[model samples]
Target: MHQPTKPTNPIEKYFSVINLYHYYFFFILFLSKVPVFWHFLSLIFLSPPMDFYCNNTLLIAANESHKNFCPCEDPWWDKSLFTETVQTKFDLYCDKKWIVSFTQSVLYTGTLIGSIFFGILSDKYGRRFACTAAVALLAISGCSLSLMPNITSFIIMRCIEGISAGGYIVAGFVFVVEHCGPNNREIVSALYHVPFNLGHISLAGVSYLLRNCDHFQIAISIPVAVFVTIRCLTMESPKWLMDQGQTEKAAVVMEKISKFNRKPHGSFKEEIEEYTAKRSVRSGHMHFIEIFKHRRLLLNLCCMSAIYFVCGIGFYGVSQYIGQMSRDIHKNIAISGILLVPASISAIFLLKILCRRTLLMITTFLSGVFMITVVFIPAHLTLLRVIFACICDCFFFMAFITAFLFGVELFPTSVRSSALGFLSLMSRFGQIVAPPLNSLPEFVTGLTFGILAICGAALCYPLPETKNIDLPSSLEDTKTLNKKNTLGDLEKPMDGQSTDIDKPDTSKKT
Candidate 1:
């Protein structure tokens, strides 16, 4: 058999060169998430309390007459090892306990709104535009947090911080996933979580570095806050450009992709033109409504929504246990946070061996088992309980990563951000449910994990699989999934066209 002759264009020749620049922006955006969860974690390590014994004499005199819980003359919780917190600044303890929960609730409320707002922005305005704007929002809100004067101001800032984080996360995730080739999608998608774990670790480290709560907030906020401007330097996804009928910009981005990767120039222009010409006008203008018009799309979205809901609350529920446990909260969080390194590595290796369907089932099933087992351990066996609980959380974390990658692989470029945003919104709601569920154990010891276990087991089964397969590039492609079929077209590039990039590349990197 005769092989087709190679194209003579130097650009085409360059196509055979090794590709490299695909992930630069991915890493940049990944680093931006460094501060997203720190404030929440700070609550665990930094909350302050006044020195007051709840004696009847003190209580009656304080309430009936003219004294505060702690005498203004007596100040406490200012030890060398630990710093003051908003809880202490406002004296939000005992009867004021609801305030802490209320603060977090407002944050989630911001996230809910951000997810919807930014998801639409990603689908409509463009990834680069939306992500850049969100970066600004998140950074500004985070920086302003340490400056807030009253609890009302603090809670209001937290809500702003949540909204900003909401936009950053969804747009950043969508941007990175869109910019990469198929070979690295799982690693890149799962890579988002690594920074989250890092954020927790760094929050722990910085909490130690800056002893004062206000300074600690500045320390954590400043690191990521500085990088917000970097988003302005990043490029939009070529695939997103193409989906929106901006073929000219898409061509420019593809050229940049080739340059960054140091691949020899190839015929990216002709290939994009051919693909775009064949695409229908309706494909250019995608609506969120369009995502569910097809049966397969509807079924897949519904199942994915359910899984996000369960996994969202479930992951938080497990983590909160370790937080609430009688042992060292910092050590337990550090150790648990470190577990993500292994969980991420396990995901990277296992993704290559097991089909996505098999892996999703196995991880969720095991996570469920571990979650359930946490309930049966004798309370006297505290060490054993902690270990079991940590393992349960590790697996849930793994499952959560798996779901992130799977969701990216499931949707097409035009609507991928919207789909993921919808999932994130549901996840937030589940997270909203988690704190309340954690409270439920006060009434019933096993309530939270028991519910999560059932959810972990039941919710992961409905979605179609995409293990080691090509992703769909359009609604038409996604709509074609048969309930019984795996996503077999995983090798297809985002635009659904064969390009010189697919040809053999014996050339070494320049």
Candidate 2:
């Protein structure tokens, strides 16, 4: 007599279906990334550091000695291009120049808090709830920026927006990737950033047309408002639903997807039940601390944190200062944004040829080299400086895409959002400190990002490659990551093929 074979992951089986919901949801999620870029990169245009001269008669003696008269309470701003900005409105020049940096730093600080808060929220609740809540807050806070009467109120609104942006970033990413199968995961994840880059490109045009920071704020917030209204059309991650033991709900979602794909709805209850029975017994839900319980998981987190710190500082620091690189700030911003499109699009193809680790290492190291090259260029050649800076930023952007994709695959489903949130927090910390670097000498800022990028590239060596491997389901699975034989075996499976380790062999001799 022959033994019966058990069902494999029923949810994963649906992952390969190119369905209507998949296209619709992917578009919605990709669109979500646009607001994030708009919010984060808005500071460059909103608080643009314009040339200013102190008009205070009391500072006549001080002004005579200083070539660049600034740091005064009241200054006459050069508003030929921009009529009003945070720098001009708040008198964030001369003595108050540090406050200019504070605007960017404070926004990142909000993102820092959001990372931890929403990370936990996603894990405890669901990705859908966390995403919707975060975007709603983003919409409200962003629109409120135009109404802020004082700098304090403006800072508060920016912080709130940052928190929401951070949450949307991690949650939205997890939501999209979880819906994809290994076959399309890398490509889908990489293409997600295309809209984000488009946001970057469009911001320059928007900022050029709307010079007032208030109008720019209102304009950018409108899309997020539209997103909040349509968020209901999207569904929660079935992988997350299954992980939480809500197999019935997961099966329902899978059936909906099947129907949208124009395929006959098949029952998934038996497969889901079989897969759930094989999982380790659980008491309550998994917490963020669960990653610390395992050595490999902890190491992976630490390594990613260190690299994320560099990426955060390197990318944001450069972006914050890129406007100052040339006389035509608008042109520089637009060009930098344009370069990211190709860099982001290239990653989709690169992932097919190279493993995750190799691609990251190459991009990060080159980012450092290009940044350092910018420092050596003569100031007379502003065009060269802008070109080099844009190229360097492009490489840094690729590093960011690789990091997000790599980190998602590094941890288990139970704590994936939590781990990513922590990494994002570290990155935000890097962003917080980045603005201050602008006050330093040009070489110092360049050298800081350059050294950090090189160090980050080195850190990538110890981490295991996740290309074509199944996402870990539990803490125990992460422990085997460091073992040579385990990774060696997992890498053998062809792209899109199921790893035997994840699926139990139910067929045996009777």
Candidate 3:
């Protein structure tokens, strides 16, 4: 008769490998952000040129052609031949620029819907399946956009890309956090964006190489293909499987993880069985209302959303306008692209050393300072503008990484994806508003940055620190943390609790 092998403690069996895999997975998912690089490149190519001769020539021509024909000076000039010609040409070149915002809005709308749908589906089906599906969709939509030859097709493809990107981002973050042990969760989450910054840096280089080439479409398509291929080889999150009552499959995944780490395999089935047995009693159906019912969760969500909103405005607004910034500073596209490397490197290091909240507050405040300085730098001082723009990029990237990690840590497992989705939706709202906000007068730029900085600094005071905290495992624990501002009142023994709000403890199970 064959003897049944004993199952090792499931939590301990996979804990170390889980940390390593989380890092590996962070790098893998970072590839998905490559699409944003294409977006960056596309913006750079489309931005108005800053050549001094060309700009002076255009202005001189306008002045000579219509010396006394100011539409503001004489209302009839608005209907005159010259004014009408200029207006028509402007409309032709930038017709429905609002289409960009409208397209983005539709994408966020889809994100709102997909977040709820995928959040539930991920819990039911598993994070691996949902994440893979999201990646496939993102790859297809992103690649399809490269083929667009007209405005309608471009807008449609962009909207579709938004949906896929939104879903992929939410699902990917949730999977990484879920797979990681408490000790490494914050760092893993922060590093999750390294590939994204790398993608941005790579896109800058790729765009510079292909800027004048007619085959720009090919440049965009290549990254999308790479993202899909990489995602196809990735493994499912074992923690997600265990949550869905698939201890047997979870154990198999644990074995694969052990093999990947080249570690000795102990039986993971016993721990899997124990975890599944406990979770099986409670049907894990998360409702939207539950997110708001808990004060701490709600407050955390609000702060996270606000942080993302401000970060989006500062980061994307500055990044998307890099071409303009480059032009104002008289830097070549290649030089501008090269300058982004420092910003990417800064994000990688700063995120590891600083707590998410402190870093966010500091970076955002500094980003505002840089933006205000940019407005005052005389156009003649090209070198000064370049230095300031690079500084802005560094702080912007730092704030972005911090914001991404903050959202991941705030919500519990049950609603992690949903909370991130909602936060992303709000961030997209800022992206939509940023262009108009940026187009405001030079003085307005300083004012806008000042307001955003002040709001972020003030809000940082009340928010709870998440650097060493394990994610809350239950609604009851979440409520206790909210009400008491500490975990002391929770009746459960320390061994039974999965997270400690007061300090970082790696021994706690999730």
**Tens-digit per-residue lDDT, 41-109, candidate 1:** 665554633334334354444453333344333323334455577767776765676797788788888
- Residues 1-510 of candidate 3: C-alpha lDDT, one tens digit per residue: 222222222543346245455557666676666664454345344332211111223454355454333222212222221222211222322334454445555665566556656665666666777777766776677667655666577667766666666677777778777776544555566666655655545655554445432245456655666666544567777766664456788788888877777775766777677655654133245555688876777888787788778877776666655655533322454455556566656765665566666777888888878877877889799778757766786687677777777776666556666777788777777766777787888568656865685587567656665654445444543443432233232222323343334232223343
Q: Give a tens-digit lDDT track for model 2, residues 201-237.
A: 8889999899998899999998888777545787778
Superposed Cα deviation of residue 299, candidate 1 (Å)? 1.8
Q: Which stretches of candidate 1 lie over 4 Å from their true place?
A: 1-18, 46-81, 280-282, 325-327, 442-448, 486-510
Ranking by lDDT: 2, 1, 3
Span of ten consecutive residues with least summed lDDT in model 3: 79-88
Clashes in predicted model 3: 1
- Which residue runs of candidate 3 sit more than 4 Å off their true CA positions? 1-13, 16-27, 39-43, 46-124, 146-150, 208-214, 229-232, 275-283, 320-322, 328-353, 369-389, 480-510
TM-score of each: 0.85, 0.88, 0.75
In angstroms, the error of model 1 at 43 is 3.2
Per-residue lDDT of 268 in model 2: 72
Which ranking of candidates, highest TM-score first? 2, 1, 3
